[model samples]
Target: MRVSRTFRLPAAAVGLSLTAVLTLTACGSDNATDTAAGPLTVVASTNVWGSVAQSVAGDKVEVTSIITEPSSDPHSFETTPSDAAKVSDASLVVYNGGGYDPFVEDVLSSNGGNSDQRTVNAFGLLESQSQVRDQGEANEHVWYDVGTVDATAQAIADELGELDPGNAATYQANADTFSGRLKQITAVTDGIAATQGGAPVAQTEPIAHYLLEESSVRDVTPEGFTSAVENGNDPAAADIAATRQLFTDKQVRALVYNVQTDDDVTRDVRATAEAAGIPVVEVNETLPEGLDYIQWQTNTAKALAAALQ
Candidate 1:
């Protein structure tokens, strides 16, 4: 989720700044002690990455997601003491960086440094792989990008192996299986693009911009409008007018709406799109319940492809 305001440290837990939180290292004790006796404990910033970790780790790891509540806006998520404890006890930590989940960083910092903990920052990994630069300029919803999500799954497997060498082979095998499923998702996206290439779409925000791009859909939403809404600010009057025009004029094939981050403006946009007979495909930042990462992406791709058709 896009963050407009900085998350404040709870009044009881004061004096922690964003810079201080970011500087906290993930490294913990080098003794190779498991956070727990039975399974490796993994903490993810949101259920999106948590689902990926769960798939890669299989039954060998216990995954906990900080943002599992569908109604919660991750941008305004406040950290709790229990969340900090979870980070402190986790053997592996996976988070979407790029300022999308600074609360994760803050939680890690408040729990103190963990030198032995294996960390995977999805945004940082993407940047290292040259997938994106300047998280602010790029879409923070990296999971929507099949290639990036695949890379993140591999990264999670690698970190799991490092944290638990005994399960290294299992991690590799699981990662390979997960990667295959991701490739299938890519093929599905390619198929859609082949049929609906250059189709114009409008979005309330850039939540699924990567997926839309992968499917070769042209997002005609004004950049100013999307940016403003994403940052929790009111869009410029001209941008709002242009966005409404895109719907009323039926210039787009579909409207990809962020179901998790709805507001008055977005509601009106959706109503207008529906009135124009444009299909509205709902997307979310968190993985839906009862579905893993692959399932969620596959289902969304199918819905989008159908809408375009």
Candidate 2:
């Protein structure tokens, strides 16, 4: 797969509507399977959770991710009726809730079969475990939260075990193995935390809130700038100037750039950081092609650590 930058327009520019589902049949059996008679199936909101579900599922179940393309942002994902059908028919549905992938919730809410379908919501799991460490508002990107990702993997195993009792032990063992690897990934951040605690950085958005927080790096980006970027609105002139000052004044050690949501303003900020000799660590919301969850996250943590060093 080719690795290239994906510059996305504002979410509002891409209309978030279920018009295709309305025009097409609302309940077709495209890629939908019967778990009782045929192979068990798991549907995830995006490949990030899908990779976790697949790790726990092993070879016993078929996992499908609605947003498979690296360029597709789950926040603005447009679901179809066929995608709804897959969710309804799946033995288990894994998603990142907490308003991250509202389309998944919209599909489940509209489908009557959702009542019988099993689900593992990563954000919901984090809330239930009281693992949200943000001061006021929680970050919806729970996949970046290592602990939450571990919990989500185990939750998928539990759900799959209940659905396919014969493979319960296999599911549990796979989840354990997956969790072990996740620990290794966490250790990298822990190392960074111990050595680079309180080191200041800048972000184009709060995409890596959990990872950066875990590593104990301070985000010096103005709240107004990140908030505006996340909301798909341009920041005020003062907010923009404040953010640029972080780079020009050498207040930040690095810039955590989300490569998926690029725009002119963010591009300019990145350029400023580059010109100031601040290392920029690029991150993605979805899994890059040809790489699994562990590999992708390991790269992220290592990249952050290297940038800090």
Candidate 3:
């Protein structure tokens, strides 16, 4: 059995010639050449990642997303025989690793992604943790973290270019545009820090904690926030009590909650923050039903603005 570490491919801005070399090319009438010259086929594990892939690959690659809705728990997501078909047929597969979307892992495990196949694990690219160091207080909602994603996008662009050298220029161009957007977001976060100031933020779960942290904002969630949310388990009563105290006692500036991943615990947390007159910034793991990845991220910036203010 081959175990492909999903976190491997990474970065942007290699040589322009390198990207140009990645462009699609006309090949001789050979079986391998025919396959190599065609449009790239990509499958992202979730819709959010699909949107990201779409932003870059555009018409150059055919992208399909299996998990389009946020309501579906990725942990319990069972792949259909068709998904296996998608896996076997795909040239590229993207997933948000770190055990957050183990379904992708399962798919890849069922059908290995080595050498000929390229797979991306967003979380695996980050600083590794033997035991999920950011657990309890910070759930691994990696898509929200700009730093990690910025790197992930670059990795995808480079690898896709490598996959079909004839389309390298297009891939690099897309990569550049996407990288600019990521940087633009960072600039926006900087503006938030400058205008809104680095306020103490509270969260029901680690929903978008990494993003908040990268924005220079501080999180003051009570312990057990991540573990409970990740497993769909209710937080301990003591933790719940402390979370309530955080609003009244610790004086949090705002609360960021996963609007889609709602449950009794998150609801209670939102209520506690609301009752305490704290503003809320709702976040979603999967892009909202109609909104694509970029628009959704733009909305996330707006939410940050509201909460920071």
Candidate that scores best on lDDT:
2
Off by over 4 Å in 3: 1-39, 112-115, 128-139, 196-198
RMSD of each: 4.3, 4.5, 9.7
In angstroms, give how far residue 287 of model 3 lies from its true place.
Answer: 0.8
Candidate 1 per-residue lDDT over residues 1-309, each given as its tens digit? 333433222222324453343334223423224644546788898999988898888998789998998776666676665566566667788998877777677666655444555788887766776644333356667888777777888888888887788898999899889999897678878988999999999999888988887888899999999888887888999999999999899999999998887888889889999999999999998889899888898999988999999
State the lDDT of candidate 2 residue by residue for 159-246, as single tens digits: 7777778889999999999999998788999999999999999998899998998898998899999888877778999999999999
In candidate 3, what are the lDDT values of residues 1-309, reduced to their tens digit?
A: 111122222222233332232221101111221354565688888888888888778788889998887566565565665664565457788888766667666555434223356787787766544265443443457888776677678778887887778887888888778878776667767777777666788876676776676677778676586456645667788888878887766478888887766777778778888888888888876778787666777778777877777
What is the number of backbone collisions in each predicted candidate, taken in the order shown? Answer: 6, 0, 10
TM-score for each of the candidates: 0.87, 0.89, 0.81
How high is the lDDT of residue 159 in model 3?
74
Q: What TM-score would you give candidate 2 relative to the actual structure? A: 0.89
**Every candidate's lDDT:** 0.79, 0.81, 0.68
Q: What is the lDDT of residue 300 in candidate 1?
A: 92
User: What's the residue-level lDDT of 256 in candidate 2?
Assistant: 96
Q: Estimate the lDDT of model 1.
A: 0.79
Worst 10 residues of 3 by lDDT: 24-33
Question: What would you estimate as the lDDT of candidate 2?
Answer: 0.81
Cα displacement (angstroms), candidate 3, residue 188, comes to 2.2
Cα lDDT for residue 86, candidate 2: 72
Q: Assess the local accuracy of residue 293 in candidate 1 as a C-alpha lDDT between 0 and 100.
A: 88
Worst 10 residues of 1 by lDDT: 5-14
